[model samples]
Target: MKNIILSATLLAMSAGAALADAHSVVRMGTEGAYPPYNFINDDGEVDGFERVLGDELCARAELTCEWVLNDWDSIIPNLTSGNYDTIIAGMSITDERDEVIDFTQNYIPPASSLFVALSEDADLEGGVIAAQTNTIQAGYIAETGATLLEFATPDETVAAVRNGEADAVFADGDFLLPIANEDADLMVVGDPVQLGGGVGMGLRETDTELREAFNAAIQSMKDDGTLNALIIEWFGEEAATF
Candidate 1:
């Protein structure tokens, strides 16, 4: 998901970062609720594009890593608190977030942010719009003419639209397209809005060595065409690549 500009609470969260041992198991944190990115499969294991990509990165970096489930809203705070070593969730790189933590080069390129509603004619500019809290979409809506409704999770934003609590939901197109396709009641509305820089792995600012290791691994994948291949495998052939 795209990032939000830091609030006072977010600034506070970045004040302290837990020190990590270089040779220990690196814990990779993620919100396992987003599909094609990160999610818990039927087998109860973390599975998705990021799951596969993260493993490859660890191998290339020669780091021992383990996955940890985290809620999106607190993901950054948890990382600073030393709950995990890195955040490999679909977190977009943004200037405000960069003030709080470090990021590797983008894995996914910049993508569109779209709105989904029960009707194609939904008033995207002036209607009640739902978005996951602390995201760029939510931040955008608050600054627009639309009435913004914040939800704790992506699924809740979709639910608000379905139950008449919201006129539409604004979020990453990669995340909303499959929902619109499977649910006949929903449809994409309004012109796509591009926000944030791109999706990248987040690390505490102090983890420079870890950040550089992942950066090298990501660059290696890009150099050999494997990264582009994985992007297509999960997000389809049209997905943007390096």
Candidate 2:
């Protein structure tokens, strides 16, 4: 019986060690549909501002890291379930979200949220506004007098406006600015609305050590002005930083 007990203890230790090693290899979760933040390039790999920022953070933290694509709706739940170690997606830091998960210091400062539509005369107050489900934009729209239409993906929200299912789509200015600039048919309307605290890396509440490592890395980038440079590279000079 003693020998059996010892064997069980040894097995548990080995399993624990394996788990530790796996945790050391940070898995960054992102919604590959959000451009200028993260998206799948033509090469079918994660690329964008968050991709670049996440890689630098991992290098500074001395972590072996890999990117994992997750749908925006399930991103947080997956992180809490240990499907990934961190969410480097351009997720805003909000009080509601903080109740469920911890966030690192702000990497991207809060920026304006904009409304885009096929026409400049689109009604901003009473018209239908589409936003990605479970986003701060969705929450903000819900409070506005405008009818809020929620979609699962950012692309779908934009499509809703193009298809005339919604009068306009509201989202991060950084994400929508380039789209509006590129498409002559689409235009940004009304003044931009600033929402949320800022964008940050998401981690499970239990993963305090992992959060600290990322926070330190973020601070390092901020101190050296690398974070601001990357923000401008992807979001242009108008984007808020540090």
Candidate 3:
């Protein structure tokens, strides 16, 4: 009995050592709800733009990566605590976030966008448009004074508009495109607001190696058409903004 216990302890230690050595395998975070960017699919897999981007970057970096679902607002705090090496949800890069965490090269270009159900009564030109709390679109909601509502997730925001709980939703235009396509009643109400924006694999201030790998791999994918292909498939058009 003592021999068996000793062997179990040794085996546990060995596994721990391997996990610690290749920590990258366990170092990824994503929203897992922002569909077409990163979301939990029907098969119970977390995937989408950010998921694929992280996968490619990990492959290029020659490291194993594991993705976990995280809420957007708490994503940074989790990263700061070393809970994740990078965040790859549909997170937009903003100067505000730069102050807290480092981000890699842009993986997705940003666009100002809004969605509304295709009801004849829909009038988002000056109606309420909800956005996920803390997103750039939140500022637009405030600026427009269009009855800004704060939702914890994009899915909720879309639901609000769908059920007429809200008039519209402001978010990443490209991300909205896919949702609109899936919903026959929803449509992008206006031309996208092109702006200086990009989504990156977010990293902690000290995780230089992981940051470098993500940045390098993103550039490689951009140059090789992989990013564009994914964008077209998800957004139904080649994504613009560098």
Candidate 4:
């Protein structure tokens, strides 16, 4: 899930005016830390499902695009400041985020959030829970009987659970599944809780032209079944698809 702080309306207005013109090389922003969505590979290049998907979408939209890595906490701020043209990170479409920026129709459908812990018997409702700062999971935990521990990154949240800093880490099921499967010490602890609408590309409210281009490109992929194929290829056959 996604969330962001509101930037000054005047600043957004100025940036929008400057970006209204057609771009020669549209910049794509991401947090290259979250794996299977976006991450740095051995070659020192951004690699993962979003990297591949973003490139294809750009190609389809006939736009020359470059990738920029930003900290997740500041991604929206940088975008509003005109550091990048769009956010193709694994950002879920939420009204909270929409208050600061616009989003394309979700590329990934609504998915479940799950809890991962050192033990299968970890308390689901009252234990200390770890979640990445500013995420919907963190907000959700704050409302529950659990004590919420916030970390700067997803990896840190998982590390918290592993190191006994918290009872469990709550996060996207897709992001946690591979980790749980590979590690015998960690296991999923409770029933899946569906969260957010789905994942979408984040754009500035002023970039309607660019947003429409990517939306059309995404729709084309869905029409041809290529989007579903890419989903299954990256997230397994059981993964949800449009």
Pairs of residues clashing in candidate 4: none
Question: Which pairs clash in model 2?
Answer: none
State how far residue 10 of model 2 sits from its true place (Å): 35
Clash totals for all models, in order?
A: 1, 0, 0, 0
48-124 per-residue lDDT for model 1 (tens digits):
99999999887766677899999999999999999999999999889989999999999999999999999988988
How well does each candidate superpose onto the true structure, as a TM-score?
0.90, 0.90, 0.82, 0.91
lDDT of 1 at 229: 97
Ranking by TM-score: 4, 1, 2, 3
The residue ranges of model 3 lying beyond 4 angstroms of the native Cα positions read 1-26, 119-126
Q: Which ten residues in a row have the lowest lDDT in candidate 1?
A: 1-10
Evaluated against the true structure, the overall lDDT of model 3 is 0.72
lDDT of 2 by residue, 188-213 (tens): 99998989999999999988767776
Alpha carbon deviation, residue 115, candidate 2 (Å): 0.6
- Tell me the lDDT of model 1 at 82: 96
Candidate models: Cα lDDT each: 0.87, 0.87, 0.72, 0.87
lDDT of 4 by residue, 24-124 (tens): 88899999999899999999999999999998887776677899999988999999999998999899888899999999999999999999999989987
lDDT ranking, high to low:
2, 4, 1, 3
